[model samples]
Structure formats: C-alpha cells, structure tokens
Target: MSKMFWLSCCVVLATCFFQMPTISAGSRVHRVRRIVGGAPAQVPPADDPKVYLRFAGKAAQIKGVLDQPHYVFRGIRYGLKPSGKDRFQRPRQYFLEGDIDATLYPPPCLQTIPGDGRVIGSEDCLFLNVFTPDLPDGTEGLPVVIWIHGGGFRYGSASQYGVRNLVGKQLVIVPIQYRLGTLGFLSTGTPELPGNAALWDMALAVQWVRNYIGYFGGNPHRIVVMGQGSGASSALMVALSNIAKGSISAVVAMSGTAISNWAVENAPMITAREIAEYHGCPTTSAMILLKCLQNVNAEIIAEGDTILERTRLTNRGFVTGLNGMLGAAPNAEGRFDGRSLPAAIEQPPMDDMTQGNIPKIPILTGITRDETKRAVESQYQSEIIEKLKGIPNFMDQVLIKNLQNCTHINDAAKNGTKQSGGYFNLLNPLQFRNYLKIARNNFIQGLSKIAEATNDALFNLPAFLTADLWSKKGVESYLYRFDHISQNKNGFGHLFLRGLPIIGNNTAELNDTVSHGDDLAFIFEARNLDGSAMDPPPVLSEEDLKVCDEYTRIIAEFARTGKITIDKKPVEKFSGSNFIQIAKKPKANNNFRFCEMALWAGLADRLKSSTCQFLNALDTTVKSAENLFFDTVAPAQKNIGQGLADTQKAIGNTAQKINPLNLFNRKPATPKTKTN
Candidate 1:
C-alpha cells in the first residue's frame, strides 16, 4: 500500500511537468520550471526586480529568460553601433536608454558564410550575452568567463553557444561579438584609419565587463578570457594588450595563439588598398579612402575580403596554397594613430611574447591531436595532388617563393633580410623538398599524414611555442591535448560529414580523425545562427558526457582558482616535455613531436647563411648518418667507451662540418686584403 501511494505521486508530478504551457512573449504567466535542452523559456514579469538593474548611471530592464539551469541576458549592447561615420573606427562604450529591451540575439558582424558565400548579419552588431547561475545580492560574486567565439575572426557569433553547462558550474559566462573581415581589420598605416578595429572592439568589451559585470553577479576581478581557434588568438592578443591589460585575470587559449604563423597580417596596407580599389573607393589620400570606404555597402566590402588571402603565404617554411585559411587577420598598430593613446597590439604578437612583455598571469592553451585532419581531407587533398601532377616545377617554384620571405638573422643588413619582422625561416630548399616528400608520399598513401604535417607546422608547433615561451618567462603555463573523441556524432568532425565544399563545412564523409572544433561540442550546448536548436541535436552518449563532464570540471576549477587540475592532481607545468593528455583516462605526457620540432628549429638557424643551397643535400645525408652512428654505435661504445670516445668525437666534428644547420662552425666573412 505504501509503495503504490509513492508511485502514484511520482506519476502525477511527471504528467504536470510535461503538460505545463509555454508562456508567450507578450503575455505574463507565473514562473514555471523549464526543462533543459528544450524550447526557449519565458522570463518573469516586468515588475520583478531581477529583471532590472542600474548600470552606467542609468536604470535598465533586461528581458532575460529562464533557461532551466541559468538565466541568460542576450543582445545587450556593450559598444555603440559601428555604422555611418563610425564605420571602421574604434569601439566606444554604449550606455543603455530607458526601458531598453535586451532579449533577442544580436546579429553577427557582417561576413559571408565560408562555403555558401551568402552574406548575413548587420552593421549594428556590438552586443554581448551574459549567462549567470543565480543572481546574488550585494556580495562578492562568481568568477566570470568572457567567451570569445572563433570563426577565423569572420563568421562566429556570441549567440551560437548555450552556456547552461558552464553556468551550472556556479560561474558567469559572457560571449561577445566583434567586427570581422575588411570592416574589422583594414588599415592604411595612416592617422585617418588605423586598422584593428575588431581588436579594439574586443578590448572595449573586456573593459565593459570589468566595469559592468558586477551588476549581473559576476566578480570583475576574477575574469577569465577564454576562446577557441581565431577566438583563441584574439583572447591572447587582447590579454597581452595595454588596453585590456589589468582587466583579464587569466587566459584560456585553446588551439590557437597570437604566435601562430597565420595570426598576424604581415602587410595590412596592401590588403587595405586592394579592398578600397575593389569597392571603387578613392585611394589617393587617407582621408578620402576612409570616407569612401565608410560610405561603401558593407556587403560589398565583406565580399572583397577574399582579396586578403589570394596568394599562398609562408607558414613556417612551407606554403600549402590553401585558400580560405586566413582573411584580413590582426596586425601591429602604430603608437601614434592620432588617437592620443597606444595601439592595442603595439607590436607583432611573436615579438611581445618572445620579449616577455605580456601580463603576469596564468595561461591555459592546447590543441587536438589532429587539428586539421578533416580540413586537409576536405579542402586541399585533390588540388594539391592535381597541381603536383600538372606542374613539373611546382615544388621548385614554391621553394623560391618561400625563400623571398626568409630572414637571415646573423646579419640582416648584409643578407637583404628584414630583421624585425619576426619571420623565422625554418626550411631550406633541400629540407623543404624532403618535407614535401612526406606530403607527396602521403598523397599516394594516405592524406592523414599530410594533415599531420600541416597540424605540426600550424597548430601543434604554435601551441608548444606559446607554452615554451611563456614557461621561459616564469609564467604559470598549463597545456593539454584533447585526445578524446566522442562515441556519438557529437564531435565537430560530424559537421564535415555532409555540408558545402568548405574546410569546416565539407561534403566529405571521411570521419576517422578527431578534427578541428571537435572539443566545442562538449563545451557548450551549441545552436544555429538563428538561436534555434541544432537540427538532429548533438546528443551525447554516456561516454561522451563523461568527457564533457571532465572538460567542464577542469575549466571550472581553473576559472575559480589559477591552477588547472584533473582528478584532484595538478596538471604538469609545460617545460617542453610536460602536458596533460586529455583522454578517457587523463594523464601527463612527455614531449609532442620533439624530433619534427627540432628539425624546424634547426632549419631556422641554419638557413640564415646564403650558403644553405649548396649544403642542403650534404646536411640531410650527414644528419641521417649521424643519427644512425649515434643510436646504434654509441651504445656499443659504452662498454668500451674510453677507447672509442676520441674516435667518436672526431667523426662527430666531421659530420658537423657538413651539416647545413651547423651555424657555429661557419666563421665570419672577413674583408680580404688587396694585393698591390
């Protein structure tokens, strides 16, 4: 009798929950508990005090909705609209007017979807969304996380991510939108229009949070700026900037950094002028160019962004001729842009990082085991193989193009190389040829190998470089590699299974590798651009949710405290050999692609001299011999060590003489005495 009575009560409650009516926007209803991963929930009445707040010397009412686990305030304008005369200008802080509605998701900054090329979004798009677990009353609040979305700095929005998972962890999450493409990053190197408006927008948003997040139960002092992909790059860039210097507490840069080869735009003026000319804008004077560009249609300028990455730029020591990778990226700014203040990114990101000019704060950065596996398979596999077949001298032509961008560090003035550009020329012709052979052979065998090479040069190496550089400066650097792939179709790799012909959205069904953006599925309950639930839903299996739980727990712990730990053990500090391998069983690992990275590092130093051409083949051949001799013969010599040690030194010195990367042996070229 007792068991039946309890069972009847449980059934009655479940029926009531399922039958609850959704409140319309205009109509008012009593507060009803909403289910997670369902339709948008309604907010409290206008008279409720939680819907109101005072910020920037004015009273404002937010139309936030109850989304089960948390309260989310969407499309709150943080900066003035960058339209009309304000186009291409630095962002100015926006204040709320009387009874302003902050409900709908703001339009994304103008950009064309990568594969479709259909331009969407608006010019008046400088808004941020805030998600809070619960509103506190006059006490020190929760640690804040300002999430910057990644779409190569062009296509992502703040609205795409539903942060119920994060907010449920007793933290506040804010996702802010910035300008993209030509409008966000076109510079003429003049006073009238200094570029990096997008960076400025980011800085201003950070400042906005520093000032106003307290009103929404967020601790301003404990702000963690986190991002993925180019968003990750932007997060690091902003954290290192003077504009948002003291505002950020910690930085979580995932899979991208400011030091990534593709992050900084080497020549902004060239791209700026091309964009100006494309829109029929006057390019004679800075003032005329700014005026004309400001007046041009925003969509026309967005379309012109394709011009930003037409030529195949050097990545470390190679060029893939892969289009759509970088488009109008961030660049260094002048100290005096006629704005009475320093530029946000005062110098190249690599320069600032190497010189230890960044903030004294903890940083968490890492990448997937295969960051661009699907990207290579989807976008450039066919093109690369076909080009190799068609052009007999294609590889040679690519080597020459890479040589032009080379920086001879020994004596830049004498070698005709720019010393200050931060281009570490990491491969000579022979070294690059050998490297190309890997890709060529992989093309014949399997494309995954080519993808591995690309990942090493692009994401993996950059991540390690960031960790190594920061660790050298005595900063607490935490690094990880997300090796866990979901059991279901919840990973970002699933997006590539069927879509338009683009790297991120490809029509290919090659789904073996854990591709780029895969970790994001476990981080946020993602939605479409229109703020609707994703079709077919990103349903997580039991195993998949375990990974998600672990991912969130690590991030949440880091946000609250400065340290990163997994399963109650502190993650190892990166000294080139320490990092967390995030898998079903998370553990510390030693070194990531050490030999390949050493090869690149050696190539950078050895290629400094003009004599690299002749020594390339000799260097490659002797290096292999040195490895064989040392690995096989050196161990045997240990038993009879004293006898062969002298002979071994002689052979090693001989090998060093021919090694192309051996810079110490090459004596300075002294001026020859003239004979009378």
Candidate 2:
C-alpha cells in the first residue's frame, strides 16, 4: 500500500496498544493543587472546550480543558506546512480555517531510517502547542516560554513534549515545530533563499507569538526561547538572528554549540544541486531546483537513508548529505546579514565574531560533566577507532594529533606531564597518548592534523567558543558542569548517573562523564510531569534526593526568575562560586571547581591572544573596572588559571567600544597611564 496508508495503520496500531484517552464533548474537568516550595495552594478545575484562535487570516483550533484560573490550550499551529513549495523556505504565516482538532498533537516530519526505507511522518508538520492557565478571553498577559526540542537536528517533534504540568506554574509554555532535514536547511544563497530557513522559521514563529500571543494570555515582550541539543542550537540562532532581535528577551541553551564548522566550510548551493539531481532535476538555478524537488514524491524524498548511506560509504571526507539533509546547520555566514545579526558561529584565526558583542540577555548555558566521554563512547568510539586503525598508534597518535591540530596545542610530547593541560590529555589521557604513538607509526605525515581537525570540529572548540561568545555579551550568564552519577545500575534508574566500573578496571571512580541528554532528566522536570519522581540510582540515599531537590529548585527558580541563588542569601559571598552542585547530596560548595571550564577559558584566551591583537592591548583598562570584572570576567575565570582573567581583562578593555554592529572595527591603542 502507499506510505501514508502504512503510516496510518502503524499509528492506529500503536494507539490501540496504549489505549490513549480521546477527548469527548463531555469530559469532566480535573482539579489539581499548586505546590510551591512544598506549600500547597488551591487551584481551580479545568472546564473549557477546545477553541479556535483566528489570526493573520488563518485559524488555529486548540484543544484544552480549562482549569479554573487557566485555560490550557494543548496543541496549536503556528507556521505553514513543510510540504509543497513551502519546503526549505522560511516559514509562511499560517492562516487558520475550520475547526482544528487541537486535542491531540499532529505528527512529526519525515526522516531517514537506518536500513532502506523512510520513517513515515507528515509534511504538514509546522505546528505549535501552548499551555496556559488563563483563557484568552479573561486573562491578561503572562510570561511566555517557547520550548525548542533537542534531537541533534535530525529527530524529535513537538508532539512528544507536554507542558500541562508547567501550566499550573503560572506561565504559558509554547512548544513549537519547525522544518527539519533538507526542508529546513537547504540554502541557495539567493535573496529568495538566504539559508538558515530553520532559523527563519523560528523567527517568524516568534513574530507570530509577538503579534498574537497576548490574545492567548502570553506576554510577547517577556518571551524566553529555550532549547536543547539541535533545538538549543536553533535557540541560539534565533537569539542571534537580526530578524529576531528585540523579539525575544531571554534564552536557555542545553548541550548546544553555536557554530558548526561543516556549515561554515561547505557551500549549500553545492548540496542543493545534488539533492535536485537526486529528485531527477539537473539544474544549478535554485528556484527551478526547488520546484523540481517540490514535485517529487514525499516518500521518495523521505528515503534519505539511501542518500546518507551512499555519502558515508563514498568517504568524500565531507559532512554534506545527511548533515545538509538535517537542515543546513548554522555556520558563520548563516548568522550575519551586513553585520546586523549576532555572530552565532565562532571561527578561529579571526575575531570578527568576537565574544564581546553578543546580545546582552539572561542566559543559561551548560554541559554535562561527562559530556565528551559520553559523546565519544556512544557515537564515535567504535567508528572513530576503526577509522583511525589505518594510521600508526591509531589511538594516541591519531586522536592526540587530531586534538592538537584543532586546538593548536603542542603538548603531546609531554604526555601525562601536566595531567590537565591538553583537552585530550585531561579527558582520556592514556587513550590519547597511546593513539598519538600509534598514529605516528602507522600513518603518513600530517596524520596528526587530520585527527586534530576531527576532534576539534566535533567537540572541544565548539563548546569553548560558544561559552566565550556568551560571556562576552555582558549578560548574567550562568555556567554549570553536572558531575553527579547515581548508583543504580538499570531500568528507569539508569537515567541517573550511578558510578559504574571503569571500562577495563574493576574499581569505580565517580563517573563524571556528562553523557548526552543526561541533563534533560534534571533540567526539564520531565519525571515530575507524569507523577514519576526523578530517582537517582539505588545507591543514592534520601539525602541525595534532597540534594537533587535543591538543585532542581535552584534551576526552576532560575528559569522562573533570573537568579540561581534566588531570595535566599548565599551563605558565602558570590565570589564566582555562585553555582550549586547536584550531587549525591545537593550542596552549595564553593570548593567545587569546573576543571573543564578552566581549560576551555584558557583555550579561549589563547585563541583570542593569537587572533585579536587589539584585545590584548586593552587589558589594563578592563582590569580596573570592578563591575565589569565581577559581572563579566569572574564567572568565566572561576577555577581557571590567572592567565585567563588577565586575557579576559585585556579583551574586555579592547572591546569597550566594540558595538554589536561593528565588532571587527578596532580603535588605535591609547598610551599607558603612569602609576606612581
């Protein structure tokens, strides 16, 4: 049968097994109590029918049960269909008509499967869901939070996320859907298609909310755009987009890297031609190419696995096909338009997109304690090692050499001498050293460069560069490193970081590797929504839960308000030790230092010194300003070496006159002042 028919059959079968409750005309309203800081308050019951929100000549019918005090609209459409001519273009304004069945979520976009066929989803997938306590008719403005889902830009849809629980917290949560894969990212570089269509989609969505969200009881001016992984990456893009400036007030990015090298180094026109040819169109003209692909069967286009596999097998040494398919991920060019937009991507050897000029808004950016380890072990470990086997000392020489090349650090010769000097050395010292040796023996000259390029492109450089950019923006940027590993070993407990034995050793050290998506369980209050407690491993005691609670509360408080410490005074002064650790027992300890952060900051400074001479000249001016030091410098320098602070002060001083519009323009240095 047809793909759509098969998909419908599968969805129907899946629904049958789950016995999902369907909304009827006469469902009773359920009342829930609101709890704050363990205190209970009365809440009204949900009692309204799903209503149609008409706007911009379109109608969006939302399904919701009105609980007294809040009319919660579950799912609503915010943008146009991803299918037909709209694919790969900026999202069009959605005009709603007829009664929309908002009670249930719409399907997600189509994606590639691993084997042969395609994963079935809908093309008309540009939709959004909103949850608010007050109905549009009665309530005034409420703070709005637009949540962007994380899936590495390849997977995830708005349907899976439910914000009913957050509605009671006195906020409106809007979960949005944007184009993914080729449809979202295909860039032609023409005025008609300037690339970054996914970002454009978000910008338009925010604009929509701004113009109409007030009717939905949301404050457009106070909207905070939040995201994780690819979603977080998209969030950063929206925050930096000139089209979206002043449209969003705050941002939250979890496990997102601002700049993507692949997007930067490669041109999208080349890939667009390939995709067009794949759809039987042989043309370089973007409009004609897009039209050709638009007419192709959606199923044929959905068969991206064929294209991805062919690209990988060819070993073209480029991230073109699948990467491009998953939306032309952001690069330096995608972020700027005549220097009006914030530079989301940071490239070394050039400080044009310096950290000093990012949007000054409240930000929450962090990485999991074992983020790298988890990333390496899960996705790259086997494939990476296998790919390097051809080279000598494949582990040490290849991996270490690769890291050094990307970071430009030349400390491989002194392996293990300074335990925490190089990123490769600190994260996986033994493996990196061994890899270096192997690469030297097996591979030809410049093998080290290859390894370093891959490593930096994938991990280290992106994280550090993003942090530097945000810190330089002069916002109240909170940095965190999650190190807690629960003790439980299986089931739902596996979500917690239970200390597991080292790969080859019987002994277990506290596994601090921030595994991918580990922070999601904590930061999102995911478990709490379904009435499930976020249980750490069984090894964690009641005290650990308390600690988790404190950490959770702190994060929630930060999300609601801008401060992490909140109304409660810090027992110790905020001497750059403002972070709270979520450990076996959550505690506010100033002694806890983020070693990775220190390393990253040092690297950022080194990069700045090598690339931007103007920043180095202004060091003294920034050092004397205590407010600038406290607000901008100290947080990044915490636990880092003194050189980091010195470099930052210099950069800050040099950047004092750097406007967001003319970041690359530098002024002549002033003579040094005499200190008698």
Candidate 3:
C-alpha cells in the first residue's frame, strides 16, 4: 500500500466520525436509529479449547457463538479488503494469512444501518459467516443456503440475520457481507471507477464458499443462493455473474426479482458526480473523483452527503420497503473491461421468458399480501397529499383507493373538467371510479390509494413478472404469496423474515397490515445487539418460532432439491398456477389482484418507466438539510411540505437540467402476473 494511503487511514481514525451513508443514485440512504451506550463488549472465546477448521491447505479456528445444535462462525474473511490501493476495484481473494480469529463479526462494511452517530465498521469489511449444525459424524457436504441480507443496497450486513434456525434443518447456512452504498457501488461507468463492485463482492464471496465451504461442512455443489428484499436482488444478480454460474445451483429471491425497476442503477456516472459535488470532492473527472474519495476520510465519503445521511423517505425514520428503494442500484457498467451489460444479467429482471439473458438455474420468487403498507406510511403527510392531488391522474393511479372507503361524485362534478378536460381519472380506468372525491376529502384514505398503486407497480407485480419469466423460460420457478396477517406488524413472511398463524384461526388479519420486512424476524434467530450485555436474547414468540420452522424447512427442501413441499403438499410451480399461498396448507391461488397495480407495472415496463429513472431525476430536484443523525431523511425532509413541494417544484423547474427529458413522463409497466 502507498504511504499516502496509510497516512489517510491514520487521519480517518483521528477524525473518528460515526454512522456513514452511500453514493449516487438510489443507494440505500440511511436514517439510522441510534442506541445509547457503547456497543456491548464481546464475550471472550471459551477457555481456549481451540476448535480448528482446515480447508484449502489453510486452517483457522472456527468463529461464532456456540448455541446448541448449531455453531455460527462469524466475520470470516473471504476476499481481499476493499481498502488502501485496492479500494474501488473489483474484490480480490484474501485467504487466511494467519490464525483465523472468527469470533465477533468483523466491522460491517462502512455504511449507515440503524442510524447512530458513531463511526462503525471498516472499509476492509468483506467477510462471510457460517452457521453449521453439530451434525452426526461423517456428515460431509451438507446442503447450503447462502444468505444475502436486505437494506436496499445501502444498508445491512451478514450479522443482520442468523442461520441458527436454518441449520436446524441440517442445512449449512452462510451469510456473506459485502460492500454497501458508495463503497461497494459507487462507479463512474469507465475503466477507472467501473461499478457493480457490490455484485462482484457477492460473486467473490460465493467463489470463496465454493473453494472453502467444505472445511466448514457445507456442500459446495449444492449451494442455494437466497435473499430477501435487496438481498434477494443480490441473490438474483449473483446467479447472473459469469463467475457464479456453476457455483450457485438454485435461488430464492424473496420479495424482489431480477427485473424490479429499482434493481439496476441506470445512471451511475451522474450519480457519482452528484455525490462528489455534494461532498466537495474533486469532481473534475471520474479519475479525480475516484482518487479524492479514496484519499478522503472513509467516514466522510460514507456519511458526507447531508442530502442522504439525514433523509428518511417515509414516516418511520427509514426502514426497508419498495418505496424506500429509491436509492442505490446495480449497474450495467460491467467490472473492468467486461461487457457493459453481461449476457447473464443483460435482460431486465422484468423481461418475459422469451426475452432471454437468464442463468439456467432453478428459481423461486414471490411477494407478500400488502408489500406497500410500510411505504404508504410516508405518503399520508399533508404535503404529499397535496402533491398527489397535483397530478390530474392521481386517482387513476390509486383506483382501489381504499376499497373500504366508498366515494360518490354527483352528476354535476362527474362530467367536470377531470380529464385533461381532466380531473383525477386518466386513460387508465378502474372499478373504483370516485377516486377523486375520496382523495380530495380524506387524507389517510387518499394516501392509501396511492400506496396501493405504488406498491403494486414497484414491488408485487415486478415480483410476479420475474417469477413468471423464469417459468416461461422453462426454469424450475416457484411463486408464492404470503397471506397470513398474524405477523403483519413486523414482516411479510416466506419472502422476508418469519410469520405465524393466529392461535386458532390462521387467516389474513383484517386490522393487521403485513408490511415489508416483517418476515425477517420470523425466519432467522437474530440476536439483538441493541440490548445491554445483561439483557437476555429476544424471546421467540410462539408464532415466530413456528413460522421460522415452516419457512426454514421449505427453504431447506428447495436448497437440497430444486422444489418445495410443505405440510406434505406439493407446492405447485408458477408455470401451472398463479401462485401458491404460504399458509397452513400452502395451496395455489389464481384470482389475486383487487386493483390495477399489475396494470401500472405492465405499463411501466412497456413504457420503460422504472424506479431507477424517477429516483435518478430526484438527485437534482431534492435538496438536503441536516439531521441525518436522527432520521435518515431528516436532512431532505425535516418538514413534509419542504420535503415534497421542493422536490416537485425542482423537477417542474429543471427537468432539462437532467440528461433525460420527460423524467416523470415515461413508459409505464403493465406487469403480466399470470403466464397467459
């Protein structure tokens, strides 16, 4: 490493900043919730009765907490650290150079997760953790599920979820941590700062597993790549990497797909430029911008953008949902001299089966009942209501506008200037016709309509589209819709964390909203680092544990064999059905939609309109304030009126400032949820 690199490292430690953020365009913008007191100290290893693991002619002591039936080996280095001279380049392998100390997780890649103002993790944070069962003797090559955690592309680490529940099924579970935000994703679309380093981070980590997992008792050949939310996006992308073609045997892209508009960053160059300018980095050229960020304090580079560090896209200080996926994305700017859009991942994840460009592998993809509930929380604010009203077609967009709140517009206003000759209804039509009257009157009701439309357009339909594409391509594709509302307060099960049936009646909860990521808590046994050292680990709710059992078993079955059968029932694939609902019986359901979301997504895909395009335009439109420390969105939107009015006005004023004209006016998606 160069002397200047070492000196810069010293300065970074000297500055000792906390909580970082991400790079240009839709990166996972963090609005972390800070916890009081310092991070609890880690418990020392047990009595030095060393547990050694040897693989590839190299050996290291196993690292992880030893709970019964499973051992979690954490913070195992799998690739060269993306630091010093190697920073911004594609990840390289980093074999064990000394005795492996796999104890506490290595610092997470430097980025904001759970917003707290304290410098966290390191740049050299490329690591993977394994959770293996204390299986019977001679139990070699156990089926493996490689997990990728979701936090948009800006947040999350392998430590976010646990494989303890998974290993209970006698499957090896590996959760890998790659770079996040600007560090793993920032690129200039040229040889100097080519992007998709984040994807390569996963590719290299998988390669490491293929090379060394046997040492930890994982099956190299039967690897099943799995993820939820953005992690699911990564899982789908990893299968597309040239290096991971054979290494990844099957995939479970939960709650996301290969084609979600939020999947890829369409304009990394401009995003990079914007981030550089925001931080006062040398933005003269991509080379200068790359070097300036490299030499700058890593903390500053990660947390510098006041616009992002302090912004929360929603009401609850930023959490994962399709709406929050407005930042950071995978890029077509291939690593090094590789293809701009590689053959493996070239086709948009939303393509039809005949569109081609997919890795030939068994795949399972699905979504939740109300994936937009969490996203809709942000749309309820008065200013957003005003903005939604500004669009003459807002009502058309939110047709199922609270099917609960029925509305009527009398004959006098019915034929009024609502068409362009306009009011709220547009070319798109729906049964819920009186959308304009409801939106004009009730705030929550109107927001609900928009949320439903946006959710269907962004998440659910895209999920259906990609899964259907796999089935069309003749891949072993399974589709599921999580309907049990018992765990709606925290997650969307099957595709996310975990869920449980109600004590006696396991039906969708009427009052419960099955928000996104609610499924995370049920699937993995996450140990809360938020608690004090003396506090006990989170007690599992009966429903949570039960659902974990169901989901883990289903995942294990697919990991081992490419198909799933839960409750002694054969879960039908998407080819033969609309979807298999993840309930007690787990049966198929074809009559799914109640609104025009699939209509919206299909229109989006047809018109080539996507989240990436809309979000990219916001870079110029949305201005930032300050408090990124408390809420991820504190900077961009301290006040609701200031947050969106400025955004809409900026766009209206400077659409030409951005490279692409007609930023908001673009093709809409008409997602085909069924094969026909």
**lDDT (10s digit) by residue, model 3, range 581-675:** 77544566763442243233222222223522322211322233111111113243267545443443322111114442222232322321221
Cα RMSD, model 1: 15.0
TM-score of predicted model 3?
A: 0.71
- The 0-to-1 C-alpha lDDT of every candidate, in the order given, reads 0.66, 0.49, 0.57
Clashes of 2: 42
Question: TM-score for all predictions?
Answer: 0.76, 0.63, 0.71
Q: Residue by residue across 1-676, what tens digits does model 1's lDDT show?
A: 6999999999999999999766553343434334578777676454233456676688876667656657778888989989879998898888765675666788888877666667788988899998887665545778999999877666778888878888878899999999988788877666667788999999988888888788777899999999987789899999888888788999999878887654676666655655666666655666777887777778767766744433322221113232123456688885676668689788877677666687888888999887767666656666545434433333333322232232111122232322111233444434444444443333443355456655766677678767876776677888889988665432464332122112445534554456677788778887876467888777777877788877888889888887877667777677764788887777788756654544444433434444344334326454333111011223332544342333322211111122212312233233222211
Q: What does candidate 2's lDDT look like per residue over 218-304, in tens digits?
A: 777788888865677678767765667898887776655454322232345544544555556645355565666677766566564
Q: Which clashing pairs does model 1 show?
A: none
lDDT, model 2: 0.49
Stretch of 10 with least lDDT, candidate 2: 497-506
lDDT at 58, model 2: 64
